[model samples]
Target: METLLQWFDLIGIVVFAFTGVLAAGHKQMDLFGAVVLACVTATGGGTTRDMILNVPVFWLAESYYLWIAAATGVISFYLIRYLQVPMRLLMIADAAGLAVFVVIGTQKVLALGHTPAIAMVMGVMTGTFGGLIRDILCGDIPLLLRREIYATAALSGAATLVILNDLDVLPGEAVVAIAVLVTLGIRLAALRWNLSAPIARMRSH
Candidate 1:
């Protein structure tokens, strides 16, 4: 379980770093800016989660997290320009990161002896807050604030994981896999179909 979580964490870091690099490139940021954004995007949610949980930050304890983020940032900075549609890549990468992070976050919180409610909240936070931070740094409106199904997808996945764990419906690995698939499916479907939550409108008196 621990090994699987670590691997998922690494995958999330790489995917989120690529999204951050793409954001920086869109803003015409230099390599240094790209690297900075990538590191923040890759670890921002986990750092926030650790602080909230009163645990030591994961990246500080393991320097390899930073190294991976940095290397991914550098590579993405050079490679993104070659792509015809960088936004598509960015969205896919962000969805993948969201899927992984939600499952990892749920497991970590559960392991730490937190309640399922707290675990679900933390899971959603872990999945979406990095992208929130990334959008803020890039001066774009955060996806979480938009009508998009961004955070909704995270919430659904986290809820599913917590429910499954509580019910003992499946093994740990199967639960994580199902949760990730749920997140990714919702997110990608939203993207593909242009689906979004409905926005409220006020009538002028």
Candidate 2:
């Protein structure tokens, strides 16, 4: 189960990194900027997860994650010159990456003996921090802070996984699959329908 989760994490990282490179292209960044944003988006969430869990970073344990991020960044950089739908591709890939990461993150936290609440929070952080980092680096508002249903979707899936695991209703793989499906469904629906939380406002001075 642990090994499988690690593989899932690697997949999520690579996918997110690819999308990060895609998103970076929307700006007028140089090659170095693209690669930096891509790498940060790939590893930011997992690095935070490991730090909070008091474990060594997973990328340190296996070099594959590093290589994947670099390769994806490089490929995405040059490929974007010829790609006409970079934004759409980035959105889809980001959604998939978020779903996968949410499952792996929640499961890993549970394996570390944390409660469901902590697992859910960690899951959201793991799934969304990369994008948050990307947005910050790119001088945009962090998506997680918006009402785009991004973090909410990740949290819902993470919470469900923990609850199912606690009840012994599903094994690790099953939990991961269900969680990913739920996350993807909710996120895509929100995107399609433009579902968002209402912004709070203050009276004008």
TM-score, per-candidate, Cα-based: 0.97, 0.93
Q: Alpha carbon lDDT of residue 165, candidate 1? A: 90
lDDT of 2 by residue, 32-107 (tens): 8888888889988988999988899978987778788988888888988886864767777888999999888888
CA error at residue 90 for candidate 2, angstroms = 1.7
Top TM-score: which candidate number? 1
- Using lDDT as the measure, the top candidate is 1
lDDT, model 1, position 204: 95
Q: Flag regions of model 1 displaced more than 4 Å.
A: none
Worst 10 residues of 2 by lDDT: 83-92
Q: Which clashing pairs does model 1 show? A: none
Query: What is candidate 2's CA lDDT for residue 104?
Result: 86
Steric clashes per prediction? 0, 0
